[model samples]
Target: MKYKNPVISGFHPDPSICKVGENFFLVTSSFEYFPGIPIFQSKNLVNWEQIGHVLTREAQLPLKREHSFIPSQGIFAPTIRYHKGRFYVITTNITIRKTFYVWAEHPEGPWSDPIFIDGFRGYDPSLFFDDNDKVYITGASFPGAGPEGIFQAELDIDSGKMISESQFVWEGTGGSSPEGPHLYKINDWYYLLVAEGGTEYGHMVTIARSRKPYGPFESNPHNPILSNRSTKLPIQATGHADLIQASDGTWWAVFLGFRPVKSTKVHHLGRETNLAAVEWSEEGWPVIGENGRAKVEHDAKLLLVNEPTPWLERDDFNCESLATVWNFYRNPLESSWSLTEQQGFLTLYGQSCTLNDLESPTFVGRRQQHFNCEVSTLMEFSPTEEGEEAGLTVFMNENYHYDIAKMIQKGQTIILFRCRVGSLWKVVKEILYDEPSVVLKIKATDTSFTFSYATPTGEEKVIGSGETSLLSTQIAGGFTGLYFGLYATGNGKCSTAPAHFDYFQYVPGQE
Candidate 1:
């Protein structure tokens, strides 16, 4: 069976997986976005559905501006593992420099509060349950900790304590930033897999093995078992992988990779989850993809499905709560947004904090899943105050974003198109409008994004457009990608009026 590379698409990075019975559960890193660590389930390797998020509450995942908030500074790499009957997810909160784990009976859960791992100081943690019922925690060593490598310690899962001193296991094959380590015990050998080369164009996955869980391990003769660096493949930056064995005794790998715009190394859709078949060598080493390279299309012999699970392209706000795809900028105040306040519409009260601020604002968004797609929203908002505004935005963090909104400028209602690139901020276009309701749209292409607006009467007009490269990771300098956001802000003062969104739609275009 042939399937696409990115089994799970868009801004979902640091892919990790764990199998229980016949079901597979996966997780990916969510940085600076509320409801962090999205959990997904799959029956077939090519098809996956988001069951829920591990960090759904503010208590479980606190993302606040006061903690020196920055883009790509909250949740890092996460590894999901199933032990006995309970599911465990361990990750790092880089903002607080803390490593913690949470557990639940089921993947879609009432997960327990974080059990902080004392004496463990690193990122990308993984849990290994040996045949003797003993649990071990392995993770990348903290930077400047003498030598960089993978560390391991005996863990008391109940108390989150390290029973033994942490020890360095394998230092990889000398690639930079040896992180995202996963340990597996296969046939009397403990194999250590880690991603190296800094997760950019040079990203790669390498492995080693030892008789014991801790050191005296030897690197794979074919080190960097998986990578796409310097290749012309559509999928690039391939690494940070997790391996799972199927019911048929076949091994597979789920990893993170990105699809750059044609002829350019710029990708704004972010690192996505990719699947590849794995086979063991005669020497008991694993070989991934086609000679360590991921493809845009690949083959798998598992029980194939007719089609992958479909995503909802249009949200009408008819449900009692926001869909699982929606995410806030940070820890959003409960009072700032509501679905029941104005039945059949998502109502967002304009908060004093604007999108430009590092603080939490009344903003809700989803990842940009396609290179060429259309995103639009029908919003009803009448701004009486000068700073009050509500509309659609293609956001790439505080300093890099493009906005098409209706605001009160110089005592007159106007439709504004603005761009913020680093230190440069400019109002590219604006038009006088007295309408209280309007539709704001953004049409994205491989190279640019076109902003337009339509009045209630249904006449659409092009406001302006901006270069898509402006929001690329190469220029923005962040681990996150672009987000299609619906935001309401007051710049500095709270607005008495509220914005109501009738519907939000994202339609992907054929390549």
Candidate 2:
């Protein structure tokens, strides 16, 4: 079977995988987005469906705080494991510097509240269940918190207590930020796999092994088992991998990597989940991908020939609840958005919060899965106040974003196109338009994003365009990717006006 890379695409990063019987469950970091740690299930390695999120409630993930929450500072990396008929997801909340694990009977949960692992520091925590029924937690040690390396400790799964003292294990093959550690008890050795080089262009996966769980381990002769560091491959930043063995006794690795736009090292869609074949060497060490590089496509013996699950592109907002694809910035106010306010339309009440605010604004969006895509929405908004605006935004973070909105400027209804890059903010275009409703569209290519608006009579006019590099991780300096968001904001004061979106259509262009 031939399959493409990024089995799971867009904003989904730091992939961790576990197998139960013939079903494979995987999870990825959701950083700052609500309902964190998206979980997916796959019968075969390539075809995956999102079962649900691990943190669906505010109690499990309190991303919003009294102090301003920085973007890309919430859930770091999550490792999902199945033990004794129960599923566990262990991860870190960097905002509060807490490492916790939640358990559920099924992948689609009713997950338990977080059981905080006190005295455990750092992130990317993974659980290893030994043949003797002992459980171990391995994670990357936080910088400046003693010896910098991978650490291990015996953990009581019931109470989330550390049964043994934290032991400094193997430091990776001399790479910066040796994180995303996963331990596997294979044959007679405890294999430790960790990602290094700081999750960027230099990112890599390295391995070490020891006879015992707590190591004094030896590094692999072929240290970086998987990486694309210096390569010209479309999929860059390859690392943060988790290995899983199939029912047919074949091994596979699920990792996080990003596709830069054309020749530039700017990826606006974020680090995506990719899969590669794994094989054991004659020396009993594991090898990944092709010569330590993940390719754009793979030919593997898959157990099932399932077609890739199609994404729901057009949302009419007639459902009782929002689709799982939609996400909020953080903990959203329930009253700020509604589906029943206007039947068959998604209505967003204008809040005092704006896109630039660290707080959660009246925003809902889906990930930009493809580089070449078209997103269009029909919105009915009458902004009486000067600051009240409602429209579409290609949002990367609070610091970097491009917006095209309808608002009232000096008592005249106008369409505004604005761009914000760091401290520099500019109004790219503004046009006077006295209309009750309008169609907003954004066409994205590898290099640029074009914005346009259409009147009720169906005449569309291009407003402005912004370079895709402006909202890229390299320029924005965030762990997140761009989101095609539908938003309503009142700048500083709450507005009584509401913005109702009749429908949202997202169509991906041919590669």
Candidate 3:
């Protein structure tokens, strides 16, 4: 089955893909979002499944304080490749302003700690290994060098290190601003593919070919092989591509595009992943899409064999380790979160005194996919002092978030819904309940959200409701999806009470 619009939709952007035998794997740059790069697998180019994130452990990629809260600025344009019995991925942390690489024997891995490359050289770095066992690293231009262009250098695969100094190979045709450069060898020619015209309205996939790995490559006559018809269409920003050939010799390319809701230009869902077919032309250039433009929909006949189970939505909490679906807001202290016994309850220990601070240590989260849904969790409390709160929240960045939480005030539980915009947090609703345990439920429809609570007798009452517009990336301005989660922290000690999450579910429909 082919997904017409989004094969892997909604903020799953800057797709880099590769095929090993009959199997295919795709990865996306996760920016500052922890559990860095998400690894997706697809048998056919159309359907994709989230295998896991490449950086589960902090050792894989070291994230600092400044880059942690802002998810968009940390990681950009990750390129994944499988070679010589190992999977290698090279990416740039624009915040840290450096490039690093990691490898694993398997795709869903215990990947090695990052091997930081030597120079503070490039951005959007990609790897290409030649047929004669020569390894090369190619990337887009950096600040000090020439104008926006593509550069290539030799590399040592084993050490994840660069061999010789890089040289400028292609300057792009006159006015074209080429970025996201990836190299491939085909039919005795090294083809350099790049995304030009910036990452905005005029974005496109252009190609230049050379007979040698490092040489004077010539641009294709039909410059843009794949692009949206820029003639007044709302959807724009359609480039930054990576290509792969299947076991059956079928070629495909994955790139990024943005479809705005109200406006024709800006993308609130961030850059979306798009797929297109490529064919080698008789004249030796690649012909992309069907008529040389990205097909707005997918071809059903080109679909492949297997289907993918995207991600694990439900957790029984009956395991010692946490599920891969959970990611910390910042790099986490592994000791801070754990499952109590082999039961269906997950416990988050308190670290930060308040949820409003960037240095807070509390881990609060839920996955970023799915549209309309409901999430509920129960917390048992034995608070000795005031200011200990535990509750549910919808978070975008540290600057924008809204939550409904219950805190202990002189042995009483106070439920309050608070929203944070910029640095201001205002209480929207408040209720005082004399209950030790209460169930908190948040129902999210297509446009708005409502919160309700129960007395454990299944008798529930509505507490607060508002526009879920806070979940938009436009207001928050980050390269990540909105997350809802359970949290606990602040000025008191919690003992003898287990935080229980009965179940979390998502049912599609407008209610």
Off by over 4 Å in 1: 67-70
**What overall lDDT, based on C-alpha atoms, would model 3 receive against the true structure?**
0.73
What RMSD, rounded to one decimal, does every model reach? 1.1, 1.3, 3.4
Q: Mind giving the per-residue lDDT tens digits that candidate 2 earns over 1-511? A: 7889899888999999998888899999988898788899988989898887899999999886445444578899999999999999999998778999999999999999999999998788999999998999999888888777899999999999999999998878889999999999899998999999998999999999989888789999988899898889999999999999998888999999999987676789999999999989989899899888999998777656578767678999999998888899988889999999899999998789889988888999989999999999999999888788999999998889999999987888899899999999999999999889999999999999999999867789999999999889988887998899999988888878999999999999997
Scored by Cα lDDT, where does model 2 land? 0.91
lDDT of 3 by residue, 1-511 (tens): 4455456766677899988876788888776567888898878877677788887776665566564544457678899998888898899977677798889989999888888888737888999988889999999888666656888889988787778888889987654667788999988889999888876667888899999888799999988887774645434567788888876677888888766544223334457777877888889998776666765575644556355454454556677766555667767656455676426677665554445555434665755444467777765544445667677877776677778877767767788887887656688888987677778878875566788887667787888776556556656677676677776676444323334454554433331
Q: Which stretches in model 3 have alpha-carbon errors above 4 Å?
A: 66-71, 144-146, 173-177, 197-202, 229-236, 262-270, 290-296, 305-313, 353-355, 381-383, 466-470, 491-498
The local lDDT score (0 to 100) that residue 289 gets in candidate 1 is 92
Error of 1 at 345 (Å): 0.5
Query: Residue 468 CA error for candidate 2 (Å)?
Result: 0.3
Task: Arrange candidates, best lDDT first.
Answer: 2, 1, 3
TM-scores of all candidate predictions against the true structure: 0.98, 0.98, 0.87
Q: List the residue pairs that clash in candidate 3.
A: 32-71
